[model samples]
Target: MRWVFLVLIVLNALYFVWEQQQPSVHVQQLPSVLNPAGVANIEVANATNSQTKTLDSVQAKINLTLLLGGFSDPALIDSLSQRLLSLDIDVKEVVVEEVDGVDYWVYMPPLVSRSVAVRQLKELKARQIQAYLINQGDMQNGISLSMLDTMDMAKDLVQKLANLGYTAEIKEVERKQKTYWLAVNSRSERLIDESLMTELTSDFPLMRYRQEMPQ
Candidate 1:
């Protein structure tokens, strides 16, 4: 009976040693793959950044300008504006002062009196020389011989008048003309393609244009 009890105690001690040698079963916590709060914040931030980029791109496109110029006639400018309006294109009118050409005026200086001017005008008419009596301004009581396009023509007329025993002077006058332009946004430039340009030219045969940046 004593030997049986000793054998039981030995079996218990061996079982304890075996349990100590076995590997530990520890439980580790893992990260969640579908965290609602974290996912919502990240998605909202990405969407906001994308939307801001798109708005900036559109703003850059809107700031550019296009200019179409060289329209001389007011009536033609009006028609073109109406045509652009019909096509839903925004346009603004711009006028630029340009020097068209020079004109030379041949005339006689103001005479001593109005009676003297009239007498000289009559003498010119009797001699078959066209003349105009100056009625007002600084040249009052003077006689205008003619307005010639070229300086050479004016000098020739002055020599002819001198041969006829008449004094004539030449005055240079600058001829200014107003040029009309249609200002459009760069975004609208795509709408004015070759076909549209051809149609516009057919409608306005005298319309000449050049493109430039906005001032």
Candidate 2:
């Protein structure tokens, strides 16, 4: 009986030593908050901050203001304002005025000419053809010619008018005291014997005709 007990104790000791030498298997627990389909919240926050910084830098480069006047269309004003703002410009003011029976929009920065503005208004009006005279003092009038130089321009205009069934002639050319005067003879085939000379004279107020002595 004593010998059988010793052999059983030795077998138990060997099993315990084998179990301690064997490699153990471990199962890892995954985080419950992780989702494969969705983007991480931290990554989204970083991207938003980067985009905002880029927009702010782009806005700093542009600096121009415009003041619009005489334009009453809220839709037009809003569209124009938004477009300019998108380009990072500032609109300072807008004013509308009615002077001498004509509506006028005075715009600051003056991107457009008075004639162009008048034409736009007329198109909006959708009736009678509107004539506009731009105030030369308000804007730069580019490259004007003297009377001698104007004669060349006038000659071209007169020739073109003559080709379109109108009778026109440069009746006299006088170089007096270092100045030249051109007498223009104008008659219209369409309005025969019906004070065409008077009409021409009124149309060209700056021109003077040569007087003819009676024979």
Model 1 error, position 134 (Å): 0.6
Best by lDDT: 1
Ten-residue stretch with the least lDDT total in model 2: 179-188
Q: How many residue pairs clash in each candidate at the backbone level?
A: 0, 5
Off by over 4 Å in 1: 1-66, 95-97, 185-206, 210-215
The sequence of per-residue lDDT tens digits that candidate 1 reaches over residues 1-215 is 99999999999999999999999999998866877889899999999999999999887656656655568887778888899879988889889888999999999999999999999999999999999999999999999999999999999999999999999999999899998878876667779989988998888887777655457
Candidate 1, residue 112: how far the Cα is off, in Å? 1.9
Query: Residue 165 of candidate 1: its Cα lDDT?
Result: 97
lDDT of each: 0.88, 0.42
